[model samples]
Target: MGFQLTADGFAKTIDALKEHYLIYAPVLKKGTGRFTDTDIVRYDFVNEASEIELERKSDYAFKEFLTPLSETLLFFTEDQVKAADIPDKPVLIFLRSCDLHAVRRQDDMYLNNGWTPDWFFKRRRDLVKFVLIGCKKSYQNCFCVSMGSNRSEDGYVFSVETDGDGFACDVPDTGFVPFFAAGQAADIKPSYVTKNDFEVRVPDQVPGAILKHALWDEYSSRCIGCGRCNYVCPTCTCYTMQDIFYHENGKVGERRRVAAACMVDGFTNVAGGGEYRKSQGERMRYRVLHKISDHKKRFGENMCIGCGRCDDACPEYISYSNILNKVTDAVENLGKEVQ
Candidate 1:
């Protein structure tokens, strides 16, 4: 059973939730007409229901809200060390089906994979909950349907969709029912796209030998390594830690973990200036394989949710789905040549 509420009732529900949880939702940031007079959509605190930006896909993923881009790990002072204090308030995040799948992939890495889950991630996981923002249509460049992540059967506390002048919601969590105004039970189905124009053909197997293929070199000439793709990706989890000392004490300060990109320079750098993956092509190859094959070898699922934010965020116009097709062709041709 479900409930339907007008726009005002929806706002009242959100306001009611604010008393218990810190609500985060997609929001539109107006532009100054400097570039193309387009509005930038991203996640922000939703104080009112009208602030949620459901019409367009957000340029940034909600991953950072679960795992921050930069966070202080601990503070140290000679003899004593102190752990960083994390926020205690619970968080309720509104996201799409693909993004919900992204949260699962992230959890697989930070929680389920190892014998001991990452403590920081575990803490964040305990404090966060998800709400599905039903997607009725396809977003440009999205390939989640191909990845089988366009719909989520579970993981969200409740699902909501806009219907005419009112909002219809499937509230599995009974606690949320009090917020809705006087309404009768109505069946509400969440919408999902059946197809996407942009398709990715993943090969049955990307042989280890394919890594030596000359095709990857194309990225060396075209890629500038701006690292926008990683920043916008929901599942890119690599990061680097830095230790900072206080100006006065020189011994007391904090250690921080800052997000990093495989495509960025010095990502593979080590002590004595030794570095692996020297070329942009090498970095690109590593990233692509990790998304499609490497992670799946251990976790049995692709790291990419096929949100296509990487395709949209790339300044150099790189298309990840196109690359997958190229790799597929190269692998097939290689198999034929060997036969």
Candidate 2:
């Protein structure tokens, strides 16, 4: 088991982790309108307390470190084939509990379910470290409490907090962290949530003749075809490929992976000029059901960590909770009628 780290001890853990791994935390970028107010991952440099934003979750998630927006699966020339040189460096990412749950769900799909989890994620999983910070209070649209993901635990290599004077540190593992000034550990009084606290009432049997429910139609209408929900979600894994030819040297070009979304209009389009989910409503239904219904049937739990990012990122103001809970209740009512 990992040791309990106080605020200062946690900082020392970060310093130690950075020695071998590339440390990435949320960094704010400013510029033109198109690029302004975005979170970009960068080398961990400053240990300044001012730069830490543990009070609120980052606008972007840490999944990008493992599954990048653009990735070259395999490159090919005229005849012979060779793997592209994507860095396999282990990357240490600072994340909240909701984000950590998202990672667990992703691992169920990619590694256990065979999407082939990236070494960047796996290596980091083995060697990378975590510096978890407990949320003192809830942030905007944060439904972590509702989803039972509001707290941190010993899974982290280090944990931190602020008291009146300085900080406290714990190295549960076997390492030294020096990022924080040493002080007495504060007694944490964080809130906790349980599995049965606020469940979505997933059916014991789903996607087994219940796929064509009317709830799909209603949920689809509120969808504006925006992909913001996917962007903010930690477990929504969809991506598209891109190939750009340099004007100067067309012979040397790399294929990249760009993030894809189910809500996007053309998301389901394929080679035969056929669209898998042509209608906006169909796309929305696909995403929500995939999270709560389909994913649960295969895996033990719903893929959604219930971060409420879908509700937060929606331009059309669609609430995933309202839609999913309504569907569950509707299905229950339908079952009673059948009986």
Which number leads on TM-score?
Answer: 1
For model 1, the stretches where C-alpha displacement exceeds 4 angstroms are: 32-36, 182-184, 248-250
Predicted candidate 1 versus true structure: per-residue lDDT over 33-94, tens digit per residue: 11578777788887888998876888899987777889998899988899899878999998
TM-score of 1: 0.95
Segments of candidate 2 deviating more than 4 angstroms: 1-17, 27-49, 73-90, 115-127, 152-154, 164-170, 176-204, 207-209, 245-252
- In model 1, the clashing pairs are none
Tens digits of per-residue lDDT, candidate 2, 197-263, equal 2345455555444566766776556777878889878898777778765445555555666889988
Best by the lDDT measure: 1
What value does the lDDT take at residue 242 in candidate 2?
85
Q: Which ten residues in a row have the lowest lDDT in candidate 2?
A: 190-199
Given candidate 2, what's the lDDT at residue 93? 66
- CA shift at 188, candidate 2, in angstroms? 6.0
lDDT comparing candidate 1 with the true structure: 0.86
